[model samples]
Target: MTKEILYQKFGYVLDDSLINEIINVGVFKSFSKDDIIIDINQPMLYIPLLLKGHIKILREDNEGNELLIYFLEAGETCTMSLTCCMGKSKSKIRAVAEQDSDLIMIPVQKMKEWFHGNESWRNFIIESYQIRFDEMLDAIDSIAFLKMDERLYKYLVNKSMLNESATLLIKHQEIAEDLHTSRVVISRLLKQLENEKKITLGRNKIEVISN
Candidate 1:
C-alpha cells in the first residue's frame, strides 16, 4: 500500500524525503479484473502509476470502433493519459484493468511539481512518452498492414503472454470487440487456426499449440 514499494517495483529508489512527499499526496487504489479505470472523454483526475498487474490502454474511433493500443504492467505509466492531464483536456483514450491491479494516483498539481522537484521523476516522464509512442506506432501497423486472421493470431499470442497462460479463458465476442471485428469473423479465423493445427479451441478457452 505504500508508494515506497510501488516505486521499487519500477527500479526507482526514492529517498525517504521524496517517498514521504509522494505518500503524502498520492492515493493508492486497487481494481478488479476488467474494471474500467479511465473512460474516454472524461476528465483526468489522477496520474496512475501501475504497481501491480496489467492494464490495457484502448483508443476508440469516432464511429465507436475500439482498438487495444498497448498494455501497461507494473513499473509503467500511461503516457496518453499523462499528456491529456498536462494539457488540461478530456481523455481521448480508455484504460481498463486487464487483471486485478494496484496503482498509486498522484493529483495533477503534485505531478507537475514533482517534475521540477525530482530528477528521477522527470526522466521517467520522458521515457514513458517515448516507450508509449513506439507502442502506438506498432498498434497502427497491426491495424493497417496485418490481415485480420494474422492480427487475430498475434492477438491470441499476446493475450497468452499477458495472462501468462497458454490457455486463454476468454470469449469470441470479447476478442472481436478488442480487435474491432465481428464475432463471426473471429470464429471463422479461429476455426481455420484449429484446422491448421496452430491452436485448439474449447468452449470459452483457446489453447495455443504451435504459436
Candidate 2:
C-alpha cells in the first residue's frame, strides 16, 4: 500500500519525502497465522507496520499465565519497537499474528531520522503513545472497577459490534486472562449470562444475545 493510504488509514500524515525514505529503508514480511512476530525478552530494533491481518500483544506472568494487553488489526504499528528505541533493555511483550499477515519493518535508525527531520512524524509518534497510554489506563480501570461479568459483558458487546455477528471468537481462557479472573469464574459467569438470556456459548465462541 502507498504511504498516503497508510497515513489515511491511521488518521495521521507524514511528509511524502519522509514516507518515501521510510519505505526505502523498510522490508516487507509475511507471516503465517499464530507466528511470533516479536519475542519477549529480546532487544527490539524495528518498528513493524502491520499492513494486513490481526495481531495480539501479550505477556506471560510468573505462573505462565498469558495476559492479553491489546489486539491490533491492519494499520497499527508494534509498540515494542518504540520502547526499545527509547532505550529499554528488553521487550516486555510478545506480538503474534492471529492470522496470515503482511508487515513492513522499519529500522530504528530510520524512525529516529524521521523523528529528527519531520515534525509531523514526531507528532504522530507522540499521539500514538498517548493513545496506547489511554488504553492501558482503561484496562486498569476495568480490572479495578468492574466485576468479572461486567467485564465479560463489555468485551462481548465490543466484539459483537466489531464482528456484526454476535459471536466472539476468543477462547474462554483468553477472556479470563484479559479480565484477570479465573477460568472457572468466567465459565460460571458465562453460564449465568446465558441463563439470563444475555449470551449463548458455542464450542469456542460466545454470542451476545442482549445488549
Candidate 3:
C-alpha cells in the first residue's frame, strides 16, 4: 500500500518530509504463514510495523510450551518487541506470522531518533503500548477467570474470526501447542465442545457452529 493509504489506515497524519524519512529508514520484509518473526531470548534488532496480514505474539515456557498472548494485525506495531528494541534487551516472547504478512522494519537507531525528533511518533509509540497493555490484561483475565474449556473455545473463536470463516483448518496438536496444553486434553475439550453443538470437528479441521 502507498504511504498515504497506510497513514490513513493507521489513523496518523504525516507530512511529506516525515513520510520521506520513514521511507528512507524502514526496510520492507515479508513472511509466510507460521514463519518466526522474533524468537524467544533473541535481542531485538528492528521494530516492526505490520503493513499487511496478521501476526501472533507468543510467550513460551522453558519446557517449550507456548501460549498465544496477542494478535497483531495490519497497521499495528508490537509494543513488546518495540520495548525490547528501545532497551536493547533480549526478547521474552516470540512473534510468528499467522498468515502471509508484509511489514516494515525500522532499525533501532532510527526508531529512537524518530521518537526524539517527532512528537507524533512519540504519541504513536505511547498509544501502541497502551493497546498492547490492555490486550495483556485481557489475556491475564482469561487465564484467571476462565476455565480451560472456556479458554479453548475462546481461542477457536478468535482463530475463526481471524480466518474470516467458521471453519478452521488446524490440528488439535497445533491448538494444544498454542494454548500450552497437551494434545489429549485439547482433543477431549474439542470433543466436549462438539457434543455441545458449539463446533463440528473433522479429521484435522474444526467448524464453529455456535459460541
Candidate 4:
C-alpha cells in the first residue's frame, strides 16, 4: 500500500525521491483501536505516519486526568513526536489509535536528514506543525468557552468524520473519558441529543443524524 497510500494523500506535494526514502526506511506497523501508541514521557523513537485509519492526540495532567488534544486522520504525522525527536526529549503527550490503523514508522535519525535534503519534507513538517497548533488552540477554546453539550456534539461530529461512518461504535463511558467528564454527564447529554433528533442512541452505538 506504500505507493497507493502516499500518492493518494501526499502525491501533489511530496517528491518521488522523498517517497522512495519513505518506502525504504519506514517500518510498517498496525495497531488496534484504543491502543496507546505514544505515552507520556516515553522517549522519542520513530515518528508514525498514518497510512490508514485515525489516531487521537491526548494530554494528561499530573493528577492523571486525560484531555483530548486533537484527532489525526490518514496522511498525517504527530508534530509533538517530531518536536520531541529533534529536541531529544521525552514525549509529553499521549497518542492512541482511534481505529484499527496502519502506519509507517520512520526512524528519528532520518528526520534531520530528510528535513535538510528534501524541500518537500521540510514544507510538510512546517505545515503539519501549524495545523496541529491550530487544532490545539481549538481544543482549548472548546474547554474554555463552549458549553459541555456543545462540546460533546462537536466531538461526536468530528469522531464520525474520522471514522467515516455515521454510526459510531462507542460507549458513553469512553466518551466521558475522552472529554475528561463523567459518564453520567455524557449519558445525560447524549439522551438530550437523541431527544432533539440530533442523534440516535442504540445499545452500544450512537448514530449521528444532524450536526
RMSD of 2: 2.4
* Model 1, CA-based lDDT: 0.87
lDDT by residue for model 1 (33-121), tens: 99999999999988998888999998899898888888998888898989998999999999999889998888989888888888878
lDDT of 2 by residue, 1-211 (tens): 6565555555455666766776678788899988998888877778887777778788788887777676776766765558776674678888888778888888887788788888877877877777778777777787789887887887778656645677787788867876667889998999999998999889898888865
- Candidate 2 or 3, higher TM-score? 3
lDDT of 3 by residue, 113-197 (tens): 8889987778888988999999999889998999999999999998888878999989998899888889999999999999999
Off by over 4 Å in 4: none
Best by lDDT: 4
The TM-score that candidate 2 achieves is 0.86
Q: By descending lDDT, how would the candidates be arranged?
A: 4, 1, 3, 2
Q: Which one is best on TM-score?
A: 4
Cα RMSD of all models vs. native, in order, equals: 1.7, 2.4, 1.8, 1.2
- Any runs in candidate 1 off by more than 4 Å, and if so which? 1-4, 13-16
Residue 166, model 2, lDDT: 77
**lDDT score, candidate 4, position 140:** 89
* Deviation from truth (RMSD, Å), model 1: 1.7
TM-score per model over all chains: 0.92, 0.86, 0.92, 0.96
Off by over 4 Å in 3: 1-5, 11-16
